[model samples]
Structure formats: structure tokens, C-alpha cells
Target: MMMMMQQLQESPVQKNSLFNAMDRFIGAVNNMDQTVMVPSLLRDVPLDEDTEMSSLKSGSDDEESDMYSYYQLLKSIRVDIEWGVRRAAADERLQQQESHKTLSRRGSSASTSSYASSSMSLSEEEDSEDEDLQKQFQYHLTGLQGVLSKLTVQADSLTKRYKKEVGIGA
Candidate 1:
């Protein structure tokens, strides 16, 4: 009986995990925004060792060590997630690509035996590529859940670190 109620509560979260993840991350950023009243105080203060280790692991834009940058990044991520900015742009690009493919296909016909055989092979390759893409998307979706949680914690940690630096509370 208890399990059924728990499952019912979790059903909506499972249905659209991305929105919930974004909501969690955005809420954390909003909390950080209120806590860190004076952002300048975070200017030169470096993030924690965990962030340093993450920078080393990711080895790209994550190389930034300053707390101020992390603060800005958290806000930026909040905006991006809240708006689905990247996803919308990517969807537009994909639509354009699909339209182009449709136009090109309409201009051609596989009347020849050789062309028909090659088209069949190309379709098989496309199927395999689609499967690969699906796998990658699923993997990224799983990663997105963990990453959202981590970013929420990072936001909280930053707020706490800022408070400590400002001698507000320990």
C-alpha cells in the first residue's frame, strides 16, 4: 500500500525527468542568487577540490577555478535549462536537415537495379546509425539526471562558501 503511493508520487517525475531535473537545478540557483548578495566577494576565491577534480576529468571549459565563474555558470545553466534553449535550437537544425533530405529524395528515384541495391544498403546503415544515436541519447539522458543533482549541490556549496568567505556564518 505504501509502495503504491510512493510509485504514484514518482510517476510524474518519471514521465518527464528532464523538466524535474531542470526544476531542481533552477531552484538551487535561485537559492544561491539570494544567499550570495554580493557576488564580487566570490571573485578570486577558488571552488572546492571536488570541482578541481571535475575540471581535470572533463578537461575543457571546466578548467575555470574561480568561484565567480562558477556562480555565473550556475545562472547561465539555470537560464538554459528553464528555457530549453539549446534543445529548441537543435530541434530547428534537425528539422532543416530533415527537410533537406526530403527535398533531395524527392528529386531522385531508384529505378535501376544497382541503385535499388545501394539504397537498401544505405538504409541498413542508416538504421544502425539511428540505433547508435539512440544509445548515445539514452546515455546522455542518464548522465543528465546525475549532472543536474551535482549542479544543485554545487549551487548550495557555492552559497555556503560565499557565506563563509564573507564571515556571515560557519
Candidate 2:
């Protein structure tokens, strides 16, 4: 029982498992899907001997080392979320710009087709295509917004967990 307890307390299996889980979490966060459920990223905090060893070499305390690890992880997560948010916002802006250009082109085409009755059918087809494009763009924008919301929630949860672990608040 003592041997088992020791193994459980400081096992390579646990560390490797945690690393694999963290990698998967990072990958899923990078390629987010609104339709799929986001996996819980938080795991039971293991006493990280590796971090402690490195910190010992640098003459830092245990608490400082743990806090440093948490800070780095949180920083990385924040950067990734920010990047995803920025990308989605940029995509939405580009879509809006394209929609505006399409509208302007349609306006000009309508004015010219006023005299050319034969091209009026083509203009109607273009309008239908524009509407379809707009719908598709809106759908993508909504999905992105959902993804952003999920990420925000995940970040908030992580922050709360970190605070709890560090004994910051009730």
C-alpha cells in the first residue's frame, strides 16, 4: 500500500497522462467547433516535481514555482484566445466589406440594366446569389461568435480555478 501510494504521488504515468491531456486541450482550443462540446480542460493539479526541480536549481520557493507554471499556462491560453477572437473579428469585417462591395456593384448594375431589359434577368440571378452569400456569411459569423463565447467561458473558469488553487479568494 505504501509503494502504491508513493507511485501515485510521483508517477511518470500521471505526468505523461496530464501532458497528453493538455496537448489535446490546446489542439481543440486552436481548432474550435461550436457544434462539438468543449472538453473540460482542468484536471486535478498534480504536484509537478519537474517544475519544482527546475525551480530548486534557480533557488525559488515551491509556491513561486507553482505560481510561475500557472502564470505561463494562463498566459498561453489567453494569447490563443485573443488570436482566435481577432481572427474571427477580422473575418466578419472582411465579409461585411465584401457584402458592401457586392451591394454597390448590384446598385450600379441595376442602374445600367434599366435601359437594357435583356440583362434584368441576370441582375435578378445576381441578387439571389448575393442573398445566398449573405446568409452563408451570417451563419459563419454566428458560429464564430459561439466559439468566442465558449472560449471566454473556458478562460474564466481556468482563471477561477487558478485563483482557488493559489488560495487567492473564497
Candidate 3:
């Protein structure tokens, strides 16, 4: 059991800062008294509206000041995570496309026996390889898509729940 736990501990996914920050954010949001705090939080500064840094950093209004500070921290961390995920996804897609192109080219141009024998076997191999690569890509893509979608849904649900709890809804 200890060895299993240690192995899980050592997994790269467990060490991801994005995951850690999100976990902490969710925990903080969950623990907050949404009815009391969130309405004021949402009204003072909405998620749709961008808070100016200068006003936030130097504002004298107590409510605006506190809300702006929290907003800044939350927004900054979220933006960072969003940028990282987008960049990582783009890089992965580019690599996959390049590998696919290379595979196609190699299969097409590789020297073998006669045209019929060579082409038939090569096509079969290419088809199988392509299918395998596609399956692998789909697996990773599905996992990533699921994680991102779940995060978005959770954030949105939390926001709506907070609004409802605080009687912020019209």
C-alpha cells in the first residue's frame, strides 16, 4: 500500500502546478460562504469586467479594495493557466501533424519490391500505423478535453451557485 502510494505520489500529473492551483482555488471557493461574500464579490467587480490594476492597487474604498485584490490574484493565476494549456495544446497538435506527415511521406516513397507488392504492403502498414497513431492521439485528446471541459463546467457551476446563493440573480 505504501509502495503503491509512493508510486502515485511520483507521477508527473500529481506534480502539476496548474492542477495544484486549481485544487486550491476550488477549495477556497467551496469553503467560502457564498451567500455573504460572493454577491458582494460579484457586485463589487464582475468576472466579465476587468479591474484596472492602478485603481485596485491604490483604491481607498474598503470593499472595492479588498474585492479588487482578490480579483487580481484569481484572474492572474487563471490567465497563466489558460495560456499554458493553450500553448501546450498547440505544440502537441503541431508535433502530431508533423509526425503524421512524415509517416505518410515515408510510406509513399520507401523502396521495396515491385509496385503492386510494395505498394500493397506499404499501404497496409501505413493504414495500421495511422490508425494506431490516431487512436493514441484520440486517447490523449479525449483526456485533455475532458479535463478542460470539466474545469470550465465546475467554474461556471460554482459561479452560478454563488450567484444564486447570494440572491444575485434577477
Candidate 4:
């Protein structure tokens, strides 16, 4: 047992495998497709109902689990926001570089009017794309904010409930 535990501790892959198994179990539970099989598998085993009741009564573990999930969602949203910002910045830089190159070429060429018109059109197209990107970012930001607010409310309520259950004044 000690050797197994030590090996598991030393192997990140083992930890990932364990988490993958847990994820699949949770997914199966959520889907309810394995409900019959689960009951049959556990038919000979006795479950600790008192422990479940005590855990539910305390509610701290549930709250922490919920908070962790919300934190992960928040992290994912932040990552998306960062990616969008970086992409927008890169697009802007690319457009500026393209415009500069066009300007330099126009100065040495005889097609000034044509180059100017093309540059204007390119700028307009880029601006439109930028606006679209901004709108998308705004939509995601608003949705994320709404979700974050809801999560905050839930966490606050959970904290209050846990406090009351433990006979602590909030």
C-alpha cells in the first residue's frame, strides 16, 4: 500500500489518470446513463448515509467545490479575454505595418491617387473588422460579468448558510 501510494505521488501521469477517471464518473452521474449499472455495482456494499448527511449539513465541502468550479470558469474567461486582446493588438500592428509599407511604396511610385484610394479602403475594412471584434469582446465581457456576479451571490449565500449551521453569527 505504501509503495503504491509513493508511486502515485511520484507520478503526475497517475494523478492525471485518477482525475480523468473521476471526471468520467462525474460525467456518467450527470448523464444518468449509468444509473442502473452503478446501483448494481454497489448493491452488495453499504453506504455511510450518516456521513453524507453530516457533509450535507455542514455544506462547507459543497461550497468549496462550487467555488473551485467558478474559479476555473473565471480563469477560462480571463484567458479568452487575454487571447482576444492579443489578437486585436496583433491585427492593429499588422494593419499599421501594411499601411506604412503602402505609404512608402506610393511615395516612390507614380500611382499616388490609386494607392491613396486603396489605402483608404484597406483602412475601412480593418476598422470594420476591429469594430466587430470589439463588439464580440464586449458581449463576452458582459456575459462573464453576469456569471461572475451570480457566482458571487451563490458564494455569499453558501457562506451565510455554513455560518448559521455552525452556530456562528454572520
Better of 2 and 3 by TM-score: 2
Give the number of colliding residue pairs in candidate 4: 0
lDDT of 2 by residue, 1-170 (tens): 99999988876665445344444455544433221232233233432433322323254444543433443454466465545546777799999999999999899787776645554577787898999999999887666555444444454444544455556565
List pairs with backbone clashes in candidate 2: none
| Candidate number with greatest TM-score | 1
lDDT of 1 by residue, 1-170 (tens): 99999999999877668777878788889999999998988876656444522442344254566788889888988887767568778899999999998877766543444565564687787899899999999999889988987888888888878887889978
Scored against the true structure, residue 107 in model 3 reaches a CA lDDT of 78
**Each prediction's whole-model lDDT (CA):** 0.78, 0.53, 0.55, 0.47
Clashes of 2: 0
lDDT of 3 by residue, 110-139 (tens): 764446765357778789989999999988
Residue 24 C-alpha lDDT in model 1: 79
State which candidate, 2 or 4, has the greater TM-score.
2
Counting clashing residue pairs in each candidate, in order, gives 0, 0, 0, 0
The prediction achieving the highest lDDT against the true structure is: 1
- Tens-place lDDT per residue, model 4, 105-138, is 7785755556455656877878997999999998
lDDT of 3: 0.55
Name the lDDT of candidate 4. Answer: 0.47
